[model samples]
Target: MRIGKQNQAFTAIATSDSETITVRGLDLCDDLIGKINFTDYFWLLVLGDKPTEAQRDMMDACLVAIAEHGLVPSVQAARMTLAAGPDAWQGAMSAGLLGMGSVVAGSSEAAGRYLAEVIAKAEADGTDIETAAIASLQDHKINKRKVAGLGHPQHSGGDPRADRLLAIADELGVSGRYIETLRILGKHAPGIIERPLPINVSGAIPACILDAGWPLEAIKAVPLLARAAGLSAHLFEEAQRSIGFIMSHKADEAIAYDGKTSSRNTKAAE
Candidate 1:
């Protein structure tokens, strides 16, 4: 197949029956030359677009933000769950991904949709969204009693990553009213903590992604990819520390236990 056309920095042209990835007309195994961050490489592969410097920075921060949570259930689960044997990475990753299923992780996309609906309605109603969001927060407060953004488990009082993401949003001219709402809420909430209970990275990223015209599920996929990255890193360290231990452990073949072990979280399927 012979083809040639281009969009982003490099163009791809099918030349010959190649053995591996042939970027452009040159053999990736030989002629390809460049230095790029994982974010850039990831973007190029998945998005087929070289992310801008700003985009790369935001993506990088987001990736690092979720990498490791210091024995958060996921980390511990991965360790204990995967001590089972040679295919440890699979089990560890499964456990790590399991933690991402929490409300804290799932809430952002829900909140994003909430804001999106509110904004669309507000805009369509001949009213500004900021004013409407504020009003909605106040009027809906008694009934719903939910904050659009603020307060995090890890940050306790606030998340610094939220601020970093907001800066990127501003530079990118992305919709960040949700962020402003978080900030305003943090400052004014009764007896606000020292850290101000700022929104975590998840909350803001959904907004950023929404503004970028992506589905909520898309933002979620990003974290999974990043979590996999984190898992690899964790497994590398874990394997190095105890190769023998990892190899020695094995799953007890289909135990008929009436209860769960601290290490075994499995339950009887309904």
Candidate 2:
């Protein structure tokens, strides 16, 4: 569908002959063997436009942030679906994508509401910011009790992506109010917040997106943006693995009427 014309030639030549230049074998028509980079070729094949240097850098940053996660819910689902059959890679990858649709995995936009709620509470109370922050932390720990963004099963201490993202944000001249809030809390309310746990990547990603002027609702789209790449690789792996051919569920277990058997186990299994 009229993709692009950059390092490409218009071929009206007949394909019935052995001299045809199919999309699969178009190395470099003239001397055709300079080892053109796959990254450049991939960008050319898709998008229909060459990305600017800055665009490439940002895209590289985001892609590098989540290239491969081991046995995450999505990856687990993908592998499970893949391990059953040879040609089920697409099914397995689709299964993985389904598991990733959430605010917690969706990143900053979905998190904006929670951040705004906490910040608004501080602003509305008009009390000392440090005091209000401490109170909010306590209240959240008790009442609302909801947290979104930044999951690190492998790296328990923190997310490695956060530092690189923050550095890029600084270079992009993005004002990070979300990150600023953490700094404020760490400096002033260390007794309650920072001492217990540190600020995470999701917290700063919100600031970076906010600096980009995107709406808070945009968080949900990130899974589609991010996991899609992972899904592509996973589907390919599943296709190669000869697993995940069919989908089936095991039979349900017996349920005890009273306390004879551990019904709690049944419920937990569910």
Candidate 3:
């Protein structure tokens, strides 16, 4: 069953012969192994070109900012998966990564798209970015849609990680329209939405990296990659100290069953 267009025939990422491997036109062992750092290499691999210093720094900062939030749901899932199958780290990692969705580590893409929408609206309507942001947010509120990358549950006042990333982007001189749009949205979001919607790390990440030349389509990859590091740590600790069952036990104790009792059980008791 063919789903979509399949015209392209070859992968541009990498290829190898028996004796040598090539990545984006560079020799893997001789040209890239020791000389290029992982951050630069990541940019090269994704964009097919090396990042400038500011881009590299911004990317590195974002990766560090999101890497390990303390035992988020994805981490818990990974830990539990490892506890269930002690030998399958890959399974545990997949379980963790698969848990990332609109609510969690995957929200960066939503935020990026939101920023782009605001920018597009401004350009299309011949208005300022701030005006465009306000209108976009108002549309979201009217539609009862979430404004992603704003209002973290724990960071009502502000997300410290977000603040730090924005500051770093400014320092690196990568604060462009996307970052400006993010700040404008943050400033006016509360007034428009009738509640505080402080910018979060997810918001900050897309703004900084997009300003630094990351494609919006690849925004989710940043958090996914960062959380992979975090998940690996949790899985390792689960293997060592084993808290997966403890979390499961705690959850069981916490949630009360509210379902109807079986009539068969009542008859048996009677």
Candidate 4:
């Protein structure tokens, strides 16, 4: 029954006695309940401190921007899981969360890391941020790796959410090196990548939040948290309208099987 470490379970996040609950050393009821919103509370939970007003606003904007992109794959997965087992709401939610990987809601983290790399290289080389950004884009192009968070298929002109978040960052005076780097990348991407790869919301999120002092490592948390709210809404609607199986049926109708005939089909042919 022993695990990696015996008699040494520990968590700095929170603890509670019968009389009180604490989160990151703050009294949950007394210090947090009405004094902070969920986004600020989330920052406290992750980074062990409340966010500045700019940080909170930037975070809130990113959260709102990413939440509820309707019927995305993760939402579809969650709805379908719920349809299969109507009683297991937890399972449905789990299905949705599990589907958020590198290609989907998880791209924010990758974009954040890439931005950080550009900033670091610029700092190290004593060149301007724009130069470093273009160089980084060139590297990605050379390697045939995707420049994460650059383009949106649906928003070919540009991502409105991304523009709004960056504007909010500027209004709040939190727009800094990362945000500048992101803009530089966007400016140069068409020339370097040979296409108009405008900055998407995923890219904007990390740039703004990172400039606001969020840890780059935790950038994915922003989207995951936002999508959880979206998924909850979806699952609730699925329960009410029962569309999980309808989505499944739509998928069946959308795709044509292009393989060897099934046994029944082959028998019919014969």
Candidate with the greatest lDDT versus the true structure: 3
Highest TM-score model number: 3
Candidate 1's C-alpha runs over 4 A off are 1-36, 104-106, 143-148, 154-156, 168-197, 208-217, 242-270
How well is each residue in 9-105 modelled by candidate 1, as lDDT tens digits? 6345434563666544445556444655667666665555567776676667667766655555566556665665646678777877787763645
**What tens digits encode model 3's per-residue C-alpha lDDT throughout 1-270?**
877998888899999999999999999999999999999999999999999999999999999998898877888889989999999999999999999998888889999998999999999999999989988889989999888779988889999999999999999999999999999999998999999799999899999999999998888889998998889888888889999999999989999998987999779999
Worst 10 residues of 2 by lDDT: 244-253
- Sorted by lDDT (best first), the order is 3, 4, 1, 2
Worst 10 residues of 3 by lDDT: 1-10
lDDT of 4 by residue, 205-241 (tens): 9999999999978888899899999999999999999
Model 2 CA lDDT for position 169: 64
lDDT of each: 0.60, 0.54, 0.93, 0.91
TM-score of 4: 0.92
TM-score of 2: 0.58
Q: Point out where model 4 deviates above 4 Å.
A: 1-10, 262-264
Cα deviation at 16, candidate 3, in Å, is: 1.3
lDDT of 2 by residue, 1-270 (tens): 677777766653213346544333443453223554443344333433444544345445544565555546677677667776546666776778777754435555555566666567778888645566567666655664434443344444556676676678678665455555544543443344333343456555665555444346654454456667776776676566533333223112344347555788879888
The 10-residue segment of model 4 with minimum total lDDT is 1-10
How much does candidate 3 score in TM-score?
A: 0.96
Model 3 CA lDDT for position 20: 96
